[model samples]
Target: MRSAVVAALALGLLGACSAGTEPQTGDPAQATAAETPTMLASAPVDLAAAEPPECLSDGIAYATVGQDAGATTVAWAGAGDRGVLFAPQENGDVCQWSAEVARLAGAGYLVATYDWGASGQAGFQAALDVLKATGADRVAFVGASAGGTLAAGLADDLSAVAVVALSPPAQYGDVDARVEANQFTGPLQVFSSTDDPQVPAADSALVVRNDKTSIVTEVSGTAHGIEFMAPDGYHAEHVRGTIDTALSQGFGEG
Candidate 1:
C-alpha cells in the first residue's frame, strides 16, 4: 500500500520546475503533498497532445508554446519582440482559463497557459516556475481562488508584468505578506464580485504601489468566477470584454 501510494505521489510531484523564492515557501517541493521525488531521471512529462495551437493573434504569427521541463502543456499564442504569458486557474489544465488565454493570445502578444502543482489542486510555487520557464520578462497573472494565490505570489518575480486578480481569497498563509511587503510598480488590476460571500471584497481594497506604478485598476461585478463560473448569459461576455480591456491596456505599457 505504501509503495503504490508513493508511486502515485511521485508521478504527481514530477511537475513544478523550480523552488519557490517566497520566504514562507520553503523548498516548494516540500510545500504540501505526500512527499514525492521531484528530480527523477524519468523522461519529461508527456504532454505532447497539449501543445499550444498555432493560431494567429492580431495578425501576428506566434509559435505554439509548451514548457520542455516540468513538461507543462501551455496553450500559447501571439508573437512579438517581447513575450506575454497567461497562467490558467492554478494548474492551467481546466477549460475555464481557456477564454482568458484566448483574450491574451489574440491581442498580438505571446501568451502562455499551463498546469501547476498537480492538476489544479496544488499550486503554491507554480507562478514563479511558469514565468521562469516561459522566459516571459513581462507577464500577467489571472485566476480565481487558489489560482488567484498563484498570481499574487508571482507579483514579485515578474515585477515587470501587470498582475491582475479576480476574487482572490484573503487567507493564503504567508503569500499575502509577500504581496504586502513587495512593490508592484507595474500595472495592477484587481476585481472582486460584490455578491460573492466566500471571499472578502477587501482583497480588492488592498493595493500596493511604488513611485513607478502608474495604474491600479479595480473593477466590481455581481458574480463569482467571472472568468468561468458566472451563470448569466453575458457573464462570459463581461469577462471576455473585461479581459480584453485589461490585456489591451495592461499589455501595452505597464
Candidate 2:
C-alpha cells in the first residue's frame, strides 16, 4: 500500500514536470518516502529509474557562515562530504534554490548556496572554508554565468575535483577570468547555448587547458545560468548527471 502511494506521487511529479508546475514538496520532516523527479535531459542513464534520494523525505539542515556587517552568508546542509558550492550569476539571489536544494541533499550531497558577500574570491573561499570546517574533504563547484567564471578561477587554488560552469564568459564584466581557466587542471565541464544573447557560445572557447579533460557542451538553445540546473528546464537531467559524475569522481561510490 505504501509503495502504491509513492508510485502515485512519482507519476504526479512527472505530470508536474510536463505541465511546467513546481513539484509539490511536503515538509521533509514529515515525509515518509523518497520522492524524486524523473530524468529530463541529463540524468545518469542507469539511475534514470532509481528512487529519488532520501533528502526528499528528510528536510534540509540550514546554517550560516560570515556575519561581518553586510557580509552574511547562508548555507544549506545535506548528508555527505561530496560538497557542491553553487555560485550565482550577476546579482542573483542566494535564496533561489529553496526547492531544488533539498533534492540534491536527498541524493547524499552536501550542497551550499550563498550570495557574493565580499569579493568574489573572498566570498567563495569563505563558503568553501565553512564546508571544510564541517569535515567535507572532496568538493565540487557549480557556478552560473559570472559565478561560473569565479568557480573556474578557483579550480586550481582550491584543488577541487570538478567544476561545472554554465555560460561563463572570458571576462566577467571587466575582470579577466581566462587566467583562472588557464591555471586549472582538473575535470571541467562548461555548458553554453548558441541562443544565449548575453553570452555567446564562443566565449567558452577562451577556456584553455594544458593537461586536463575539458568537456564543452554547446547546447542549441538559450538556457543560461541556473536555468540549466532547473529540473524542468532543457538540461535538467543533464545537470543531475553532471553533479553525480562529479561526486563519483571526487569520492568513490558507496
Identify the candidate with maximal lDDT. Answer: 2
Write the residue-wise lDDT of candidate 2 on 225-248 in tens digits. Answer: 778877578787786677667556
- List ranges where model 1 is wrong by over 4 Å: 1-73, 90-92, 116-135, 177-179, 207-222, 226-242, 248-254
RMSD of 1: 13.1
Task: Give lDDT tens digits, candidate 1, residues 93-189.
Answer: 5345544444443444444454553443223233333334434455656656555655655566555455656666643545561346555555555
- Highest TM-score against the true fold, candidate: 2
User: Each candidate's TM vs. the true structure?
Assistant: 0.56, 0.68
In model 1, what is the error at residue 107, expressed in angstroms? 2.4
How many clashing residue pairs appear in each of the predictions shown? Answer: 2, 4
Q: Where does candidate 2 have its weakest 10-residue lDDT segment?
A: 39-48
**Residue runs of model 2 more than 4 Å from their true location after superposition:** 1-58, 61-64, 117-119, 173-176, 179-181, 208-212, 252-254
Clashing pairs in 2: 42-237, 42-238, 43-237, 55-106
